[model samples]
Target chain A: MMYLFFLTALFMGWSLGANDAANVFGAAVGTKMISFRSAALVSSVCVIAGAVLLGEGSSEGLNSLGNIDSLLAASIVLLSAGITVMLMTRLGLPVSTSQAIIGAIVASNLFFHEPLHLESVSKIALTWVYSPLLAFLISFALYAAIRWIINHMRIHLLMIDHYNRILLFIAGAAGAFALGANNIANVVGLFIFPFEKAQVTLLPFFPRLSTQLFFLGSLAIGAGIITFSKRVMITMGNSLFELYAVSAFVVVISSALVLLLFSSQSLSQFLQHRGLPSFPLIPVSQSQSSVGAVLGIAAARKGWHSIRRGLLLKIAAGWVATPLGAALITYVSFSFLSLFIDL
Target chain B: MKLFTGKNKMLMSNIDSFLQLIGDSSTYFHKALESYLSSDENTFTEYLKKVSVIEHEADELLKKVKHDLYAFMLIPDTRADVFRFINDLDNIIDSSKQLLVQLSIQRPLFSPSLSDGIISLVTVNCESMKALIETASVFFRQPSLVENRALAVIRCEEKVDAIGERIEREIFSLESSYSLSEKMQLSQFNRQICSLSDLAEDIARDLIIFALKRMV
Candidate 1:
């Protein structure tokens, strides 16, 4: 029964991998700086490593928004998020897995009559906006600095090409790692702590059940990358960003750094110890940060006018629609499922 | 790392060799014409053969560089610009070889009195080509200097234009010393030689644009 419910969380992970992996390596593959095969392989491996190793921070943050203590509630939340992502996508409605999972968790918490952690919820909400803004600022400075360094280096064009290929590969890998580290929480965070006592001896290397769950979730994400990410990498990567190889490098690295900033527990501790403002560890949208990074490049090339107001409106619309759509579906389904099962 | 760096260096060397051949072809074409004007027919024949060889070598280098560029998918962003620039640069050697070939076959005796004007035109044309070569060589390494060198080509073309007009005057006025057919042949050579500097100037103009568009 538990294994059957676990498939929903895997579906969320798979959907994320199919779509968001392009945010990391799409430009590289589109520019032909990196082939799709190498990109998918490196991305799949790094995502799993990041999820198993550093995915705990955001998982805790996501759990705080609405902690689901019961197995039935946790599985229900995961199923709702999975359904919302697929259904909304099928209807051509804007959706993000991060937003969908949050909405589903909120609905399940309401249905169970559990207290909401409004402080943590607000903090997580703030990140949805701040992450992209921070990416814009970071990439703006990064692009200018990189452009200066490359110009001053006076490298030959062919040498620049060779070096760029190497740098893009590294950036794409880092972006994948960061994606897994931050977003893996959204895939299976609710289920991680609740199932900590389960005796699962599948992996001798990982003794903790949370690690086992994260490993399983990341495998789904990895499978998604291997099976379905190529078309998205080719279509969405360059079409959305339209970046040159150099701009792609800057955009990817900036977004990766943003994801890392939010997901790394040690980095958060380092900042908190120094009396610096540490960001709330949360799973922000990778696709949004990538867009922000691209906007930063556009602003650097032209002025602020380069940012299209229409696109901003669409983003705002998605921010509202994705979560609301998921919340509405989760709420209605929970109400209906309550009559059929004893909770 | 070493593998890619080594490939980049080898590609750079191939490009350098190609550009050098263009330079050598222009020089040999001018030398062949100067020797012929000075009545050193043997030296003219040798230099004519030299220009032909240099042009062939340049074509080979072009083919190799293009093959490597596509095989490795290098400089994806700027490769099209590179392909265009190199193709135009090859035109310099092509035109030079054609001029040399025509000079070898025609052997139309250029009079000693008009040698000074004709030699002046060749010198100015060579100067224009040299400026274009300098501009192109630095295109990848130092784009900032490309526009400046391109300006120098323009200056040389202006001089070539002025000198070509002066030579035209000298050739048409030589009716007393030569027949009408001889004058017409001399005029045709003058037009063709002056056209070389025009080609150089056109390529130089495009170099400025290519330089501006270079990705760092």
Candidate 2:
């Protein structure tokens, strides 16, 4: 049964690599700055690097839900979440795997009446509201600043372009790294807990299995990035704006800052200790923060007409629907799986 | 009518060549402008030749840049912008050359201050471009120098703006010997040149900010 769950997670991660890759390119491709192939290549490398170096936070979240006590339950939870995500992917919806994982844990807990961590759940939901808002505000100010310097100041054309390119490259790379550091746990945390419980040798030379799993989770995300990321790259480079390097820098910096702040484990722990409560480790969607920042920049430039309200709203709606729909599917699937194996 | 006739085709073509050459000369002229304004005219004559050669080369390369851009399988990432920049620079050259060609052909005497102001702007513009190129060339090695020079370039634009205001006043105060149409055409031409210099200055400003990763 545990094996089935592991297989399901593998599928989820694979789909994630294919689906979420679109977010990386929407802007780059739309602007004709990069071809789909080039965007894919860059994103894949960056995503893989991101996942391996930063995959810790989400893993911890999966462990705290108390769903990893037995191999069978862990397997069920993971399998159910993956299946739910796969369905969402097929429908072309950009949903958060973090939300799916949490929803599954919540539904699974009902069967045993597990003492639910309402505090953590609330914190997680709060981030959903805060991350995008923070991104929008930061990007808005940055763009306003950039426009002012370009218009009001005296300068040369070529120099401005060169500087913009350099800044964008640095910020974009940082954003990718942050995405990996923050999102890796969404796919690997469930599996890691069972290894910890089984007392398995994480490494012959080292006894700490959790750390090993963290490394593996990060590597898997990196692999996902390298193998499939063209679509998302196009969406980012082009569809977002007539992005000069300055605008690109602003968007990347804002999105990365927002994701890192919310996903940082030390910060989360500190918040929990301060009587603010904890949030589950879930990959905050880079797509959300990036789009919010892009829109913020565009609004600063051309007012509301600059925003593609219909498309942005559609994507936003999908974010809301993914976890809800996934939770329903998981609840039903688990119910069916349980009927076959009487506990 | 005589200008448009077949017998004068050679003359028109010569004029076309001159206009094209002047258009192409801006980038190189900009380089010379940089050298001259920086008080370093060690290679002023060489700078002049380089500007001249660039125009000659543009005549040689124009068909090709146009043709290749059309034929190439343009990587989606690099297509629009590269072409846009090249074309825009080319248009600036064409307009500048045409202005000179018209003056030579018509031999209409105009206000000395307006022409002097235009010439001065050319100097300021060259300063801006020089600063931009030097800053770009040494950006990674000395970000601050690039930034400082870019700031200086931007400051020079203010002088160009002041000159523009003076030129506008000159236009309104011109004597009644010339027809309103002629005055309008000449004023519009001056305005275009001023606007172009301002745009070049704006581009320089953007570059500096881009390098610094912060707006100054």
Candidate 3:
């Protein structure tokens, strides 16, 4: 049972990598700044570092999903959620892995008559509102600032172009780090407490086996991105909007900041007291945040006329459907699996 | 017309004929339009023959650029855009030739501003083309100078637009003692110069857009 639960977390990590890394270097590849191979190599390293360093916050959020004592049930939920997101990605519909996992957890709770935490559920829903709104406001400000600098400084184009490349690369790295730290829970959260109860053994040199489990999850996520992120990168970069390097950088950084600010538990608790809102670390799909940023930048530059209304509607509908769709599939799969296994 | 095939002789041969033809024709077209404006019939006749010959030579040069584009399949650099730029220069000459031919044939009196507007439009295009030619010739030797050359070309194209718009407005307001048919023909002649100027501007814009895409 212990081994099966660990394997379930690994599968979840793979889905997280496939769906989320698209946010890190998708725009850069879309704008032809770097090739797919370079984006993969850069993002993989930075994502791992972010997970190892700042992945703790979301690990707690993952704990709120309730206990999974039956390894068979958890495995069913994991397999169903993984297949759902992978199929969506293959079809070029950018679905959220975080949403899939949350829905699965909710469905798993339904099977046992466990009450859902309305606070966590509401936080998840609120992210849907704030992410796009924040991205729109921030990108508008960034573009306006860039235009003002260009007009006032009268900087030489050659010098600016050279420097802008370096700045874009660094921003790309930060975006990758933010992705890992904020998104690690989508992979390893289910197994965090489970691993401790199971007494998973590791080398004596390492103090805690949980730290090793986190590293393993991050590594699996990196592998998933390296193997299958090219298609998503092209779809995100080219389909939504064509971007300049500066605009791409601004969107990527803005997305990472939004995730970082909203996902922090302390930040959310502080905001709630002051009548400001916060979102759950879970279900804040990086892809949705990125799409919002791109739309925001496009809108700020050319007004609402610049956006493709049909595409925006399609994306919004997909956002609502992904989790519900995944939950239904997982719930049915769990019922069928329970007839065979008596756990 | 020399038969020498040595390297130095060939280098001098290509530069002397092409450069001199372009340089002399650009100057002649510039002055012929001015002479036509001032109603200096003697000056117009003296420069007309030279300008017509220059236009023919420019046409032949453009044909070579087209031939070179197909012959060199790889296109050492962005020679297609350069060819397009040269074709625009050829068009400006073609329009000037037609204008001169019409002026001699019709022999109608014209408003001073009408001729002045046409002359200024032609001058702007000629100056822009000269800068473009110089930039393309030195591009390979100094690749790092792409932005500078591109900015200069863009600025020159804008000036051509400004002058063309001025000329277009002048044609509508001109008063002439010619027949209605003659006025339409004169108006069309003025339009040809402005359109030719616009053609040059389009080529320059295409070249700059292409070059920037490649460099950055």
Best by TM-score: 1
Q: Write the per-residue lDDT of candidate 2 for residues A38-107, one digit (tens) a residue.
A: 5555655666566555566766655566655666665666666777766776876655676777777777
Clashing pairs in 3: none
TM-score of each: 0.92, 0.61, 0.64
Q: Please provide, for model 3 over A3-27, each residue's C-alpha lDDT reduced to its tens digit, 9 standing for 90 to 100.
A: 7566777777776677577777776
Q: Chain A in model 2: its TM-score?
A: 0.79
Which candidate would rank higher by TM-score, 2 or 3?
Answer: 3
Docking class of 3: incorrect
Fraction of native contacts (fnat) of each candidate = 0.47, 0.00, 0.00
Question: What's the lDDT of the predicted structure labeled candidate 2?
Answer: 0.59
Assess chain B of each prediction and give its TM-score: 0.92, 0.56, 0.71
Q: TM-score of model 1 relative to the true fold?
A: 0.92
DockQ of every predicted complex:
0.40, 0.04, 0.05
- State iRMS for model 2: 16.4
Most accurate candidate by DockQ: 1
Looking at candidate 2 chain A, the ten consecutive residues that score lowest on lDDT are A154-163
Q: What's every prediction's RMSD, in angstroms?
A: 2.7, 12.1, 10.9
DockQ leaderboard ranking: 1, 3, 2
